[model samples]
Target: MFKLLFLVLLAASVHQARPDGRIVNGETANSMAVAPWQVSLQTSYHFCGGSLISPTHVMTAAHCYQRFGVTVHFGSVSNANSPNVFDVSTFTQHPSYSTGITTDYDYAVIKMAQSASMNSNTQDIALPDDTDYTGQTAQISGWGQLSGSGGTPTLLQVATVPIVSEDACKSQWGNLRITDRMICAGGAGTSACMGDSGGPLAIKDSSGKWVLLGNTSWGSSSCTTNTVSVWSKNANQLSWINGQMNS
Candidate 1:
């Protein structure tokens, strides 16, 4: 989760409920079969994660912004070899998003400067759906850190976590109120860590296609296991995303 807009987008803002970019207790991913739509949002280095929603469009967290520019890299699990890259043609965050917290309207859209090259390992994920997904399991992936102080992985890392009930999710968040716009997941050894902001938290649909459900927004300060990670819900943002990304 992307913790908060915390200053320059990637520093201390990540608190008890902060934006993060890591996969704890996750396995090295064979991303082609499991996470083809995943992309590393890089600028000098890998800073965040995102999902391809169309050949020229992407979905990410608003807090993953860079003042200069960002490049989208994909088509391979190993970050060292991801050959396809594209400059952003446009970057749009929900108009109502705030800086205090990276929850609610923390989502954003990115348009590649040109049509992206798609292949067996590089493709688009399903557009978001209307389902609540409160009790279902979803997959989380990224090239962020392996732990709070661990080295970031060169290969993609993935973990499956069950979405926590909204009530349970809120209770766990303590002072940071869990809004309807935030979907909660991960309360076990598997959790997200720093650098995983703007990444996807998704589930397979009836057709077995991964559908975007949430965007990593924030997590615990230590990114320890058993801490629930928060996501920016996608269902409520369908109209907003469809209208803005196409505009």
Candidate 2:
């Protein structure tokens, strides 16, 4: 599984200054529409991100954890808030994770020392049972910054994109090696970018539950550019995700 490169939004340079004055291409906002406790993984020392999957487990790109020591934040999206930062006790990247090549199994989970407390504002999203998300429209929500040149939003941002065929995605990417473990979303000129990794790609299931179908992964540099999202929907990995969550 290839760790997608973090693309910093170009707009962030104007609104805020990162610690080292390094501009990251992605941004996110704090919004009441999303659960208040839905956390974004961040670090004072690193650039990658992660998502809170359960009260205690965070699902994120394996490389994000490997590259930066795992640290999860809850209750608030800003670093100013006093957050409970827990070191990852253990993590399991897909056994076939590849360093240089993009693979369908670019997913991993981190277990924290203690479980997160649940409330109306903090809860775990459900996961789909199988790879049955053929033509469903899903909503991806994140506090990640917007665009490669913008500032992170103060409110959580939510976008709706339809699921696309893997074949079509491969065609868009000049027939790159798109595997069954992945799925594509966004339009010809819209998508998720940096700081959005490990976020949920959720759709309403047959029971009307917002079940997670994919985790935010790599895409093109710009939202206006055609981008393909690599997901963890491959048969074996999907099973593992469900099994880990006991879904």
Candidate 3:
């Protein structure tokens, strides 16, 4: 989690539920048709978000991996419950991931103990290619918050905003480097903050299919501020993800 305390050292910029909160200016999604791949990472309560990439695997942020028990809830949009639930069979964090002001390689994958049943209500999202996403509208969803303050909704929240260019993102972030392996979206008013770590940030393809582009990692130091949120670009780690999922 990014700590306000982290401003002193490095962990200061990472996002979380306590201070980072959830979606700002988003709508409640109660149907799977909206985010069929959405996965709520919970430990008694929703702590983070994720996306189903395959029947047996999920994509999320490295920091979301926990040694404690975590229930993966999906197949529904309700923040409180879902028809699908799984105990983690594996939690694979990227080898290079670590928490810092410039959190690098923040992506990770989770393997379910049992494969998720495929249906209209429950499905996996397609992975992204290296194609440019500039100016494309990115839809990010989570079970975090509506207004910034610490409160989660009974339904999932989603915000749609255009992807920002690397240069512009770098410019806004100032000294912090915006690497090629990352993707930035949400600026000005609408953004995906809250406790949205590991949630999916996607764009509809020409066919109107949702393609997974990135996973929520960190955002501005404050959620209420109109700051750009960052994600672990999926195109940069397709090989590693496939390898891990197959293993």
Candidate 4:
């Protein structure tokens, strides 16, 4: 039931019997071996995507923290058998987050019941500096559906998307209220869908290190080739994130 919408305003709500599908124009199948920081979140009712920010902390969309009983699965691509499952000790979402409106401040932090074992298969992703990323190339990974009518994939999926400027993205979203706290990427045939919500939008820095840039927030319902996907800008919320993690 992930990302099965056709309208622009609905965004993609992929949380049902099925979670989400593979990335568009991506590998038929990929392994978590590449994106060790990527994570899968299991709620009492459904699944959402997430990223490992620290040994004991995960970052995802605040909207994804619906009810209690959330769990984090690490070191696996297949949703069927996530080798490592960690109970959530506590969670916190942005103070100003609200559903059905613009998702400008959609962010959340989850502390694991215990610290995750740091190894090659499970590691933390680096957060970016306070630099601009309007024209950078980023990677989006998820298990969302391949198409509106498609099924969720067994293996994790990923795709490369170009970050678009606020002016360009605003023109397409029209009145959707694009804010500086949000980053727009993926258009038309290339975008993140329902199941992909709360996942990471990461970019490689000049030093070739992956930096977390955005979090999957919302996109066109149709998952079409022309719709721009919206993400929560991580750089804009670094101070808030640090405050929560430090507290």
Off by over 4 Å in 1: 1-15
Q: For model 3, which pairs clash?
A: 2-14, 6-12, 10-101, 21-194, 21-195, 22-194
Order the candidates by lDDT, highest first — what do you get?
Answer: 1, 3, 4, 2
lDDT of 3 by residue, 16-124 (tens): 3122336778877757788889898888988888899999999998877787798899887785768988999898999988555466687889998999999887889
What's the lDDT of the predicted structure labeled candidate 3? 0.76
Which segments of model 3 are wrong by more than 4 Å? 1-21
**Displacement of the residue 193 alpha carbon in candidate 3, Å:** 1.4
Q: If both were scored by lDDT, which would come out higher, candidate 1 or candidate 4?
A: 1
Give, for candidate 1, the lowest lDDT window spanning 10 residues. Answer: 1-10
lDDT tens string, model 1, 47-165?
88999988888899888877566888888888667788889888888898765533557889998888977788877887767766777889999887777678888888889988888
Residue 70 lDDT (model 2): 55
- Distance from true position, residue 226, model 3, in Å? 2.4
lDDT of 4 by residue, 48-147 (tens): 8889999999998876775578889888878668889899988899997755446558789998888888877788999888777777778888777777
Q: Pick the candidate with the highest lDDT.
A: 1
Q: Each candidate's lDDT (Cα)?
A: 0.79, 0.55, 0.76, 0.74
TM-score between model 3 and native: 0.90
Task: Give the Cα-based TM-score of candidate 2 against the true structure.
Answer: 0.76
On residues 27-67, what C-alpha lDDT tens digit does candidate 2 reach at each position? 24443235443455656633344556678777766545454
Better structure of 3 and 4 per lDDT: 3
Clashes of each: 16, 32, 6, 10
RMSD, candidate 3, Å: 3.3
Give candidate 4's error at residue 196 in angstroms.
1.3
